[model samples]
Target: MKRFLYFLSLRTGTELIILTLLLNKISGFYGLLAILTGLHLSSLQLSMYVYSLFALALAGYLTPHLRRQSPIHVLGLAWFYVIDTVVNAVYTAAFAINWFLVIGQHHPTAVRFGHTILEPENVTSISIILMLWGLRIYFILVIMSYARSVLRQHVYSTSSSTGLYRRENPSDPDSGTSIENPFATNREDGKGWEGRLGRAMIALVRSYWLGVDEDDGWARGMGGKFRRSGEAPVTFGPMERERRRRSGTGPLPPPTSNPAGIPWATQGTK
Candidate 1:
């Protein structure tokens, strides 16, 4: 029950969050069509629908690159979230105004659904719209939180060979300790989705909301004492330099005098 609650909570996994965003985009698309079919929507609503379509397309293009820690992709998606929020707010207001006016002036005796005559009661439709809007609001906040975390890490974090976040200047001899970025959104290094997806979500929440900044100074002192694990060894050249010397692989040096500075070639000829 506890685990189930966690899953359903606002703090969902990254993939789940993206999935929700995609669904929201799809719903917005269809909702626009429904509104257009039922009534004459203003130019503003039409513009909003076009904007939503563009945002959806941008998100689909950038998602894969964003997962690979591309800063540009992350920034693009962040801007989409912000612009989409404002546009959505405007659209909602417009919708509410139209809905209220319809209820007020066009109070019909009955709404004909094909052959059936049903009493005009928008209560059910309004309630559903409100519920969806409320959920969408929550999702927007979560996405912004996640984006802010990514931006922070992009500015402050360094990359490791494995493409994970590392403390800045990991190769600096005086850098003390190599600290991993706490805000790293990538799944924890391992095999299963549990390690990558579930752990990444938990870590992202902790780093962003719980204030888990990378350990520095005294906490890192002990870690600093251990030799840097991922440092690549410095090699002046090739190992074959010494091996060639031992095996006398190159051209022989010019012949020298045998003894007492006498030339060996001259002595042999004499």
Candidate 2:
């Protein structure tokens, strides 16, 4: 159920943000504000407002523990909330615009023009508000889309490519593994969780500059020179070497013996 909610949040959030953007494009700022006010007002019609308030309180209460779990998950969840806001904004704009137009017939003077140069009337104000709401929604949707795209690319890149090759004998170097089945897992290939994670981090960094190259096939570059077999080795410069020397003992040295049955270093001879 929790996982379902997580996925649902992502999908709904994306859709909402997109819809919000569309609303803003159709409406403007005052329109957005008016729509928000209307939505807030309408909240009195049901227990939605109470539930929303409660949910927020609960989220705040669990925030510390949630943060400790996985910061990435927290960020993903935030993306969903932003999406939801966009969705709400779009809905509010649509509702406010329709209500204003329908109610305007009964009260024509309520739509009176302002004293400003353009003299935008009540109807114009309502339209502008709707447009603004749409625009805000669009902004949030775009940001969320970009984030999700980046995250997906990261996930793909870090996952193991062992699933890309066919089984092969350990001793037979000449017997090449079949690459026909790109997504087939070969346990002998040494591609595991850790290797995949390293690939993912590297892919994330690379994706920023190169963009996603999804068509290159899943195993294309996964087993190449770029994929690390083990944890990356640390390279120390002169400054680091000096710092290490001053800090304490460096890596432990090998054992040695002196000719006179005493350790060479302990003997203190020339």
Candidate 3:
């Protein structure tokens, strides 16, 4: 599974985030430059740039948190990226319609290629638009994959640290334990607005946001998680069961409710 981008191989979410911000800032700079150069801008173009400014601010705030395994900030940034993708698409569609359909109809034909009279500017712009949109789709995938990695990493760390986890049998490999995103729309994270907003933002693409995809395993590495049952995954220091046994305690009990502040699972008393 290829976790990173195919060409650059950007492995971490932080790199993806920084790349996103840097590209957007460059875009913003170009927009401002156009304004300075006396290039007349349509209302739609101006609005699109304005929305990008908001995104830049939000992403900037969340960017620093990308380095940390903090779920709230990471999830916030992921949701922002997904929402911005949709919003940007709508703006792009409007711009494309204006450029290709309305404005192109008014333009004088400049180039003749075989049986068709094609404008060189249109051909070049069309090719560039297609390529940019394709790259945008790939960026969304990498960002989501990285977000999933961070969310799962936090969950695994919490489970190991608190010695509370959900498994059919305590001896089962940690790989069998659930690592669902608590902030996902479907998760019963009883705590207020964060879950609600997550649902609202991701409801349209719930499956994509929450479910596994190609290369997710590669993104969610086995440093402290998802090891085979035989490999004996260790979190923190000593095994929880081993410590309990040495202290003259019986095997640990199953988790009653979601421990480690995870609100996604609820197990019966065992």
- The candidate scoring highest on lDDT is 3
Q: List, in order, the clash count of every candidate structure.
A: 0, 19, 0
For each candidate, give its TM-score against the true structure. Answer: 0.45, 0.34, 0.58
lDDT of 2 by residue, 60-83 (tens): 443342324332433344454564
User: What's the lDDT for all of these models?
Assistant: 0.52, 0.44, 0.61
- Give a tens-digit lDDT track for model 1, residues 90-127: 77877766656565555453243321212234566567
Residue-wise lDDT of candidate 3 within 156-264, one digit each (tens)?
5444433323443468564344335455444455257877765564455555545444544543344445443554455334565676678978567666775566444
The true-structure Cα RMSD of candidate 2 reads 14.1
After superposition, the stretches of candidate 3 with alpha carbons farther than 4 Å from their true spots are 6-17, 26-41, 101-121, 160-190, 198-270
Measured by TM-score, the strongest candidate is 3
Between the candidate structures 1 and 3, which one is better when assessed by TM-score?
3
Better of 2 and 3 by lDDT: 3
TM-score of 3: 0.58
The better-scoring model by lDDT among 1 and 2 is: 1
Candidate 1, residue 157: lDDT:
36
Candidate 1 wrongly placed segments (more than 4 Å):
1-12, 24-42, 108-131, 152-270
Better of 1 and 2 by TM-score: 1
